[model samples]
Target: MQIEVLNSQASDINTIFQFYDMAVEHQKKVFNKHWQGFSKALIETEIAEHRQYKILVDDKVACIFAVTFNDKLIWGDRDKDSVYIHRIVTHPNYRGYSFVKEIIKWGKLFAPMNGIKFIRMDTWADNDKLLEYYTSCGFSFAGTVTMEQTEGLPKHYEGISLNLFEIEVNEVAASM
Candidate 1:
């Protein structure tokens, strides 16, 4: 099977939303909290800016994710030198493929090329399984933070505590 990563396009919006909805349904079955859904405009902007990405296996979309250069509200001052990953959703057919590790491998190359110092991501603070999974995928737990200012963030982030995870760009190469 051939695997490729590419920026998402406007035509892929419906598929992306479908994946997100599926993810939320899965979350409802396994976790206490689930995504509240993202705004269409926000996604459109990410697409326009080339921040949205998808992994295709044999020309079919298998996973989707977004990346941002800034996440000051969740990360505070440390956000400046990092690329924040968000909204990772894998299609059910590809469930056991370990795509998060692929994203990390992609980030290792993407980060330094963009002059980023670290790759960062966040998940529900109480998600022990994800914490362990992310750690196993190469991230170090950077502690948790309760979001105080969620004005521009997704509704799910409001009044919630998130566990942060990060991998320094330099460390990625060393680990490999």
Candidate 2:
């Protein structure tokens, strides 16, 4: 399979939303909480800022995700030094392909090149499966935090406790 990672464009909004809807359906089946959906403006802004990304398998979108330079509401003081990953949605056809691992590999390279110190992501604190999966993918379980301030954030983040995962850029680079 030919795989390519590239920044998403505004025109891909419909496909992105399809993947997100599928993800939410999957989440509803497996978890107690599911994404409440993201605003069109929010996603459009990410696309315009080049913070949205997609992985394509032979030109078909297999996965999509967003990144932010800072996430003070969740990471607090440690936010600025990291690249925060959010809303990873993989197409059903690509479910078993280990795309999250690919994203991490991408982040390891993308971070330092952008002068970032760490690659960080978060999931529901109660998601034991994902916590284990992220650790297996080379992230350290940084801990859990209960979100106190969710203003301007997605609805899913409101009043939720999240499990933080991080991989230092230098650590990955040194090992490589």
Candidate 3:
């Protein structure tokens, strides 16, 4: 019932990694290419930086994600007023809960409080199902871009076209 930043507790490390493995396993079954998974230290850094987050349902982490203020590698310094969403992984037992739609709704209320104008995210350009799903969830597809630089990006993003999605704050407010 709540979305909050994950704290850097040692116990959290195992749970997060477990979730990542579950996601990777699912991805392997469903997609030709998938996330290469992140290192525990990378997650530790996100936790320490307050970028990692979880959606708690009944006091348990049902879904997890990370957000960043800037993603110049994938986004190319396009929008300063954006919160870039990343690494959205759902707990296997929590599937079918529509957690992404929940995150989308939460972003509407949460983004503006921090002076953000856009709720932005990107996925592999080839992930058609995801593109359709995100579109159905209220994101506008902003076309795809092949990253020009990839050194600082995650492994999956090193040399691929990425589909961009964004929900402008004004648009959400207008609809509501």
Candidate 4:
């Protein structure tokens, strides 16, 4: 398996949406609340910004995710040397393969390559499965935060308490 940046010029946008929609349905079943599906324009912007990425297995996109150097909206005022991970969606065909582990392994390397010292991710505070899964990946449970302002963030962030996870770059890389 290989991880690569998403190429806007060559990638299929609809395929990305299909994955998101599928993930939404799956999340609904697992967590009872699904992510608010993103807009095509938002995705296009992410692609143009080179923040989207894909993991390929046998020439097929197995999973997709996005990253940002700073998530001021979520992490607000935290001065941590970290890269923020968001929206990890795995193709239904690729389920049961533990893509989060793969993403974490990849993120362990990817963060340092970009000169970052920490890897951070956040999700709904009530999502215990996700918090546990990330902790198993070596992320430390930082705590829960109910952001006072989430004006420009995704709909899910509106009036929500998010669980924070942080993995020191060295911690993840050493284990890997």
Candidate 5:
């Protein structure tokens, strides 16, 4: 398993395209706007801007995860201490491999090293499976967000609400 930050320019857009297609086929299963920000071009832009991160195993992409240090939620900030995990997806074919937990563990360690003390993530309010997954991975439900999506890709997803979860990297590490 090799986990490193792939530059957007270095990222393979084809992988994202394939993942986007699978995500769209089972949008409800994951509780995210599958076609929203992860389309080919958008992902490329995000990668180019260094707002996204990915994990690959055996030369096969296993997960897509992104973070923004500038956006501070309830816990920490770029200058303070938090990393907000935005998008995370495991290839559908790679499901049931327990790699999700590995990814979280990696974040707990990596975020702090990058000056982020807490790791925050959110999912659609209706995605119970994801909610459960996060909880089991040691994230605590913090709150809900009902942001207005009047512009950009968010605009394409109208009236969608997301549930937030967070876990302090230090705390998770100590517990481990």
Candidate 6:
């Protein structure tokens, strides 16, 4: 298996968007249908920072993930060198291999070199399967997001609360 960390660019962005769409369709059992596009501004903001775009490949694209501190509202803010994982998605065809787990492990190991010592991520509360998967992958449930759904997003109105998870890279590594 080949795991690579990529950056957001015209070619890779298109590929990542397509991968996300496919993953949502394939994992509809967990992903909400309303998962929408990140505003152009949001994408650009991250792009301007040149945030690390993490990808896992096993002959083909298996997963896509990006870690940055700005994903703070859902994931939280940590001190300098801290990071939050965003958009971690696994291709439908490679779901059984536990690709997301590998993505998380890769992030933990790669973070320190990038000045990131902690990593955080979030998921919907209803997605028990993913929650367990992250926990099994060494993430501990930090808290639940109880805020009222935002006006624009259908998920908040759909009555699904999100569960937040966090993992300290050193802690995760130590346990391993």
Candidate models: Cα lDDT each: 0.93, 0.91, 0.82, 0.79, 0.65, 0.65
For all predicted structures, in order, the TM-scores are 0.96, 0.96, 0.90, 0.89, 0.76, 0.75
Clashes of each: 0, 0, 0, 0, 2, 0
Ranking by TM-score: 1, 2, 3, 4, 5, 6
TM-score of predicted model 1? 0.96
Highest lDDT model number = 1
TM-score: the better of candidates 2 and 6: 2
Candidate 2 per-residue C-alpha lDDT over 1-176 given as tens digits, one digit per residue, 9 for 90 to 100? 88888999989999999989999999999999999999999999999999999999999999999999989999998887788999999998899888888898888878777888899999999999999999998999998999999998999999899999998889657346
Candidate 4 ranges with C-alpha deviation above 4 Å = 1-10, 171-176
Candidate 1 lDDT, 1-176, residue by residue in tens = 98888999999999999999999999999999999999999999999999999999999999999999999999997878788999999999999889898898888888877888898999999999999999999899999999999999999999999999999988548346
- lDDT per residue (tens digit) for residues 18-87 in model 3: 8888988999999988788788788888888878778787778888888899987777758688888888
Among residues 3 or more apart in sequence or in different chains, the pairs in candidate 6 whose N, CA or C atoms overlap within 3 Å are none
Model 3 CA lDDT for position 72: 77
User: Following a full C-alpha superposition, what root-mean-square deviation does model 5 have from the true structure?
Assistant: 3.8
Candidate 4: Cα lDDT at 176:
71
**In model 3, which runs have C-alpha deviations exceeding 4 angstroms?**
1-10, 171-176
* Candidate 5: segments with Cα more than 4 A from true spot: 1-11, 28-34, 37-41, 72-80, 149-153, 171-176
Worst 10 residues of 2 by lDDT: 167-176
Report the lDDT tens digits of candidate 6 across residue range 22-119. 76666666465446555555555566677636455744666776666644445434434667776777776666777667666666776776767667
Expressed as tens digits, the lDDT of each residue in 59-89 for candidate 5 is 6787676676654332322224666776566
Worst 10 residues of 3 by lDDT: 1-10
Model 6 CA deviation exceeding 4 Å by range: 27-34, 52-59, 75-81, 148-160, 171-176
Superposed model 2: Cα runs more than 4 Å off: 171-175
lDDT of 4 by residue, 1-176 (tens): 55454443326688788888889999988886778868788888888888777877776888888877888877877846888888988888878778777767777877777777878899889888888888987789988899789876788778889999987787547457
Error of 1 at 113 (Å): 0.9
